[model samples]
Target: MDGITGETDSLGVHLHYDLGNGDRLQLLRLATVAPDQPLAALVPLDGDGLDRLEAIDRLLRTLLGRKIPQDTRLTPQQRRRSRHMLQAIDGRMNGASYRDIATALFGADRVNDHPWKTSPLRDITMDLVKDAFAMIAGGYRTLLRRRHRGS
Candidate 1:
C-alpha cells in the first residue's frame, strides 16, 4: 500500500484478510515458506500449527458478501475502502509502527497527535491490516519467482 514498500522483502511476505464475519486473519509468508510447505512446519512461537488460513479465507469471502476470483472484492464501496486503506497502508509500507499506520489512515486529529493510541477512523482492524500486507508481500515474492523462472 505504501509506495515505500513497492517491493517485497528479500526473504518473505505478509498477508491480511478481513472476513465479513468480524473475524480477521493475519498471515506472514516467510521468504522460504512456500504455499505447499508441510503443515507441521507452520508452528507459532508456542509451536502451535497455523490452522487458520482456511477459516480466514472463508471469513474474507463472507466479508465481501460474495465470492470473487481475486483476494479483493469488486463492489464499488468495498473497492473504495480498499483503495483508501491500501493507500494509507502503503504510506507506511517501510516497516512503520502500528500507531504510525493508524495515524496515517485516520489522520492526526482522530489520532490526537498521540504516538501510542489508535485512530478511531481506521475501518480495517489491525489484524486485517497485517494480513493484507502479508498477502501483498507474498504476491510480490511469487511474481519474482515466476519472473526468475521465466528468465
Candidate 2:
C-alpha cells in the first residue's frame, strides 16, 4: 500500500488512504486486524445509516477500480442546476443585479419575454441565489449524504 498510512492513538487508528488521481479516504479503524485481513466498515444503524453505507460502497468501488452506478449519482439536470446556482451566487457577489444574472443564465430572450417585475426567471434566479448563500453557509454538508424520501 504505497499510499496508505495510519496513526495509532489512545482513541483508535486513523488511516489515510490516498489514490493516484487525488482522491483520498480517511478511515478510522476501531480495532487492530491481521496483516492479511481485509478492512471492514462499522456503520451505525440510524436515520442516515443508509447514506453513509452507500458512501462507503462508492469508496470501495473506487478503490477496486470498478464502475459506480450512474443512477446513484447526481443526474444531469441536478448537475446543471448546481452549476447555475454557483454562477448566480458568484454573479451576486460580483455586484450583478438579479435581472442581469437571469439574463446571463436564461438568456436575454427568455428574461425579456416577460415583464421584469413578474418574470418567472426572476423568482428562479432569486431562489438560486438564496439557496447558494445557504450552501455557502454550511448547508452544502447536507447535500453530501442522500436524504430519505421525506427527510
Worst 10 residues of 1 by lDDT: 142-151
**RMSD (CA, Å), each prediction:** 17.4, 2.9
lDDT (Cα, 0-100) at 110 in candidate 1: 61
lDDT of 1 by residue, 81-137 (tens): 566557655766777765667666666676665434343444353654765676576
- In Å, residue 138's CA in model 2 sits off its true spot by 3.4
TM-score of every candidate relative to the true structure: 0.32, 0.77
Q: Which residue pairs in model 2 clash with each other?
A: none
Cα lDDT tens digits for candidate 2, 1-151: 5578999876567888897778777877766665457778889999788988898888788768799865444667877888999999999999999999999999999999999999999999999999999989998877676745785
- Best candidate (score: TM-score): 2
Lowest-sum lDDT 10-residue window in model 2: 28-37
After superposing candidate 1, which stretches have Cα over 4 Å from the reference? Answer: 1-73, 113-125, 137-151
